[model samples]
Target: GNLPIKKVLIANNGMAATKSILSMRQWAYMELGDENAIKFVAMATAEDLKANAEFVRLADTFVEVPAGKNLNNYANVDVITRVAQEQGVDAVWPGWGHASENPKLPNTLKEMGIKFIGPPGPVMSVLGDKIAANILAQTAGVSSIPWSGSYGGPDDGPLQAELNDEGTIPDDIFEKATCRSVEEAVEAAKNIGYDNGIMIKASEGGGGKGIRFVDNEEDLKNAYIQVQNEVIGSPIFLMQLCKNARHIEVQIVGDEHGNAVALNGRDCSTQRRFQKIFEEGPPVIVPPETFQKMERAAQRLTQSIGYVGAGTVEYLFNADTGNYFFLELNPRLQVEHPVTEGVTGTNLPSTQLQVAMGIPLYNIPTIRKLYGKEDIYGTDPIDFLVDEYVPIDCHVIAARITAENPDEG
Candidate 1:
């Protein structure tokens, strides 16, 4: 049931685009050979074309997209999808940015009969919403931090009506619904306890944007207002923050045939603000048993959701007490995925494309070798593939560099 993918559209720019194009070529050459190699189509803006970007030069062909708007050219779903159809692209690979996590892009591509090299639109929507993801994690038997609000409550229920009518939560419904008012947040915070502090989070927030911390009830109102204003109309929720924790994530890939495997993990603890600046693989700080538990939890969650393609399951690990809580699931290839790739020796971008082409996990070359079984019949592949500990080949670390304008600050 393999889908024929002769050409792919790289729907991103800069490093993401370059890496994706190279991975596609390398995978095609190494696996398929010269004549059957996949061709890549890269997009460029007028500015990019003027500068002769590396990805444009690397691709087999290029398409020019409109420039100078609020959203980047690659982020425009209509333009990207239209270009894909016109170019006869068999698949679209959104490499971790632009429209990578936007369900609209994939939904549009699906409607157009072009393959999306990521999870389906509905799956992306579920994982993109923090509340829904948390609920999914808990349902998959993954551990999560305690929080208030009825997870997955109806949008048009009494809670929504109350928020629409008065812009506040009734005291009676404070414990069972998301906080629409400062008073309700404060109440939820008190119930959840403020020992480690409370995090006011926007369910739709990402990249460290719509979050605020309050150590006491006195600062709760201002923090709540700040987050609400920052991400307007996003549902806000309260959770007990885990103090002195390390950010650890498991690299996982699932396929359409209900098979998944954990490709070890990375420790992304070092950060500036909430953004990770340094990342390393095989989080040695945590006990091996703890790491295995995390891998198992991640596999269970991935299988439970029927996730297809590469994704990261992040967790906050308290090394002091050996406890961890599910933070969130990033439903796309992460920027720091190379660290896991280094230790695990897997090309994730290529794997994503293969999964999109209806390739099962057991049929994937790297996964098949790692599973180390001649025949996978009569075994639950999820458990059979990941139950044995696969030692990381080596340790690797990555540091992100950024340049900021001093004058702007």
Candidate 2:
């Protein structure tokens, strides 16, 4: 029954790794009695340490790991476990992206008696797979985005490019059938009333990489093949496109005992090419009642799967219909989490560590309270010393995404 976490290893790299390091540092300085009580360790490649020397400076210990050739292969379970075991770290937190949602990593770490700071492996396995997560959302009374169909390729040949069967999809949800072959794609497009338009998406894709919008028959054929080309060895599906839709999401945190709480909502409609560029908390576009509905649905889905730690539930909201559908659930810390934390006045890193260490959600941090009855500025504008929860009354936004220009190529 050892609950004191003296050391934590951040088994991640890049910006997420940097942010986690800073958050832990701030947490230690503000909450923990001793700033150096929680020894920090960052597992990075040689190049990573050289480029991000600041991480090396912030962390108490820096361990070298293989960066591999790409992001997916950068972080490995063996490397993380070896470092944790050698350095005597009590927990390992996978910063966002890369192997953050890998079920095997958590499963292996837990088996080794190391605390993996995130949801359980079984829960992650369910959420990581889009098809399983959608079905789970439906069962939890949360309306999921309508899709043409769902397909799982043969187990023996995972990358077999043969057309597969259309799984059981709800009548209201299913719009078109999947087109594994070029011929089937053409036939299915005509059958689904292609006048409006159809969207081709990879079942396992994220960050708007494998989504293609096709408005005509010719584009459908081209997009079908193009999508297959973009992402091979993955099942693809088609869905009807909702024009002028708003992208919104709800942030939720849960504990081991199945208690989940939703931290308001965020509107991330300002996106380019399906990638969000700007996000704000307490969505201004969604009505209050609808926002409450989204929060409830998100909590229902989170608790339904017995999810723990910090996660995000995304949705597609249509201002016309006043209806929203579950998009996906990110079962790890998200990039836009800071906006939620800013408004809620909660230290996410501290809460996440507490939850990972089996501390109840209610006991981790005190709810924020108003400093005075007047609405004016002063040295200390607000107070978080209250024992009960207080309503959130401000807006926080997150923006800026620096990237190289593809057109330059």
Whole-model Cα lDDT of every candidate shown, in order? 0.81, 0.72
**Candidate achieving the largest TM-score:** 1
How many steric overlaps does candidate 1 have? 0
Q: Please identify model 2 stretches exceeding 4 Å from their true place.
A: 67-73, 149-195, 367-389, 406-409
- Show model 1 residue runs off by greater than 4 Å: 69-72, 149-177, 373-386, 406-409
The deviation in Å at residue 360 for candidate 1 is 0.9
Q: For this target, which candidate reaches the highest lDDT against the unseen true structure?
A: 1
Per-residue alpha-carbon lDDT of candidate 1 for residues 252-280, written as tens digits (9 for 90 to 100): 99889887789889999999878889999
lDDT value, candidate 2, whole model: 0.72
